[model samples]
Target: MNSIVNKSLRRLYLLGKTVRWGMRPCPAGARETRLIAGAQRSGTNLVMDILERSWEADVYHESDPRAFQVYRMRPLPIIQELRKRSRAKCFILKALCESQDLPELMEQLAPAKAVWVLRNYNDVVNSMVISFPRTHEDLQRIAQDRKLGGWRTEGMSEQTYRLVSGLVKRHGDALTNASASALQWYFRNVLYFEKGFYQHPDIKLLRYEDLVTQPQRTVSGLFEFFGLPYHPWVHGMVFSSSLRKRPAPELLPEVAELCEKLWQRFQELEKPQSI
Candidate 1:
């Protein structure tokens, strides 16, 4: 009877602590007013790095617990704190699309502008497969790291590899399968010519190809879009930055054909007239 009572008391105490922490106000100078969202491996990191170097933009590379907790207390309250901290007009929040808490974040940053970056779907998938292997052995390794049962131990099949491969073969499938991963990239670009929030007037859409092919023009346009002074040095810096390293794999003829088709589709989607 004493043990049961003590357990109940402990639960109550933890609940109270959680509520208290949740209600605490976020510290001054810690919310982001600007944001960058995109699929993984889509140059979001590079863009953030360049923006920080050129514009003196305050960018948080990952989600901050304090900021998140504060955001939970009140939407946009963090923005005020960020403004106070940086004493800059813009604060950039960089987060993986699928991982962000959308409704809450959107509520807080309703009027904020966003930058969405996209890469060819085949490239994105190929990169993921290389970096995050889906083989049973790889899954087992991941599970061990995560303190979960290994795939073999858990009696899970090795079908994850096939499933991931199939999904990557479909263009824009990342946005659909991992919506937050590629949400802004897929959705906003698709609706760029349209009006309203779906089209997001303040959002700027950029392609990884353009960044690679014409760094100067692309960075210049980005700075201008954000109302920041265009720095000549930024062009060179962005170009010289290390590209994401990927092992070269001889593409199957079919995959190569698919990549070409998707690349063409991307070109069609990015025509200036389309926007």
Candidate 2:
């Protein structure tokens, strides 16, 4: 009970802080406000690093502890305000918005631009499974969303519990050492965003290979897409940066084939005429 009470208090405090910060009036960013969004194990960070160095923009990554870039740490309004006020020619930021959350995030933050990075499916899923194995923490996040400190049991209906439990039973195999969840996750987030968010006028897509092999041309196009000046120094930064590192599990051949098909579709979708 004490633990539950503490969580409640924390939520209230966060809500209060958000409300306070949001009430103040601030202008939206004049330069393009970008959300560097992609799959968890994809090359979002690598892309952000290159862009940050090349454009010399005010770049914020998932590592920003003070702001909690993954969740609502300093509130969306606060981040938007800071982005507008920053001295950089373009202010770039990122958050983890996958599946259904993408549209809601765009509606709230209303970024003028977005960069979606894609990686090979097998590599992405393998890396995700290795880096983020299934755990109790995953369910705890759902409980937090429910405004409860614990999961499925404390203040949850049996039906709700059953629903969640079914999902885990269907996907979770922590004991099996297989990554069914990662497979589903890849399809869900990748296809969902590609079908929904890619249609948005402000969004841009880039393949991981393109960014690494043809860094100058790809980044120059990104800058042009966002209406920012292409800098000569960006080439140096790209050359200096490292390339993709795949995670442990031997990639499945079937997954690789599916991923290639998706990549081809992605290329087809990227044509300016499609948008």
Candidate 3:
């Protein structure tokens, strides 16, 4: 029958398309690729700064146009161009990508390294209150585009924006209180990275608090792990009076519980490993 034939043809076409996609050449490179991934405002930039200061490694921040521009383009080309452009013995790209992409990035780049930065949940939530879009309109725009996600606001109520703003007002830029929605978003990104890369041999997890108190030793260890030379760079790094403390946010009961569980899990991962 015409209907049966049409269905068969459509299925066959899809099968052919998949085959072509699979056949596309994977990226090949001798230059090592390292991904710096973590929740937003978790001090990935500071980590990168240390990496840059302590070693001669090439570091790319997320805002750099090169970071994910070619993400949509087919394979090989992406990493190939990255290597050719960076020309560093090893290339570090700061990317907060999905856990789903971990296997492929490893499979395609084969032996790619990753670094994850962790910070206190309360501090992170508080920092986000200062850093993220303060207006309800800006928050709505982000939800629609979800430039970052697991997906954010997927199951949460839209009133989350109002809740966060209210926290800002009560705490007065300290955000000593957090909304459940913000905690959920943080948990998803942090937990996803932990579960995906916890067992991977090439990944390293660093704590912001440690990096704050003891910069030289921590950075030297990271460079040594990456097989790069270590230098005295942290001495030149600037510190703000704000780094020592924030009035820790008073979290809601459920938000606090989820955040505590996340802390416990990350603590286990933060153990000093051989890089």
Candidate 4:
């Protein structure tokens, strides 16, 4: 009885908390701002850091609960509220691709610009395999524990082995699979580009590889794109060598091969001829 009551109380508390955060207002002067949406691990965080460091831009990190909640409400209201609160001449919101409702959110913030960043599919998968090995393991373990899923969910002792095998077999895959993950990334980029955001007179597409290979050129282009003053600090903030270093064991050749296939597909998509 006590445990049941505790669970009920916790559920009610969570419900109230969600409602409170969900209904919060956008900051004043933030309407009609720029949005940066892309796949996870695609340098979105790096871009956000650079933008935030700029004195002229009021850049919000993923901290705003309202950013996500606004989509649940009518899009226009959130846009109006955001514009009312943003103090900078331009506001930028960054969200991951899996954040699903971003297309609708972008439409609401229309007349706004966008920067879509992408990395090589293999590199992305390699990064994920390294960054969240436990996630791969958990999925397999859960599947086996539940006894209702496919082979990928079968008994798995180590996450790394499971991920490699899963990727090779392409079985009961989750976000951890390089091909699926890469396809998802490609889809997100395609969705916005197809929506005509790239040619919307305000939007621009950026590649993660370019940002790293030509930091100055990319940053300069972005500054020019937004009509913001270019500063030396922005360059310093753009490329963080420490941030890009891989900390985990290297992914095996089989995993790398899968990622390469995804990368090839992305290449075929033809990035905007010029940002």
- State the lDDT of candidate 4 residue by residue for 28-68, as single tens digits: 43434677766666777888867755545656566556654
lDDT of 2 by residue, 216-236 (tens): 778778877766668756556
**Model 4's TM-score against the true structure:** 0.60
Candidate 2 has its poorest 10 consecutive residues by lDDT at 148-157
Deviation in angstroms for 257 in model 3? 1.4
What is the total number of backbone clashes in candidate 1? Answer: 4
Question: Which one wins by lDDT: 1 or 3?
Answer: 3
The candidate that wins on TM-score is 3
lDDT value for model 4:
0.56
Per-candidate clashes, comma-separated: 4, 0, 2, 13
Candidate 3 is scored at a TM of: 0.66
Please, what's the RMSD in Å of model 4?
Answer: 11.8
Candidate 3 per-residue lDDT over residues 163-272, each given as its tens digit: 43344344443332245335544544554543556767777777777776776767777777777777765435635343636786666665577568768767765465
**Candidate 4 stretches greater than 4 Å from native:** 1-32, 66-79, 97-103, 134-201, 240-262, 265-274
lDDT for each candidate structure: 0.49, 0.56, 0.57, 0.56
Indicate whether candidate 3 or candidate 4 has the larger lDDT: 3
lDDT of 2: 0.56
**Residue pairs in collision within model 3:** 176-249, 176-250
What lDDT score is found at residue 260 in candidate 4? 58
- Span of ten consecutive residues with least summed lDDT in model 1: 175-184
Please report the candidate that would top lDDT against the real structure. 3
User: Over all chains combined, what TM-score does candidate 1 have?
Assistant: 0.53
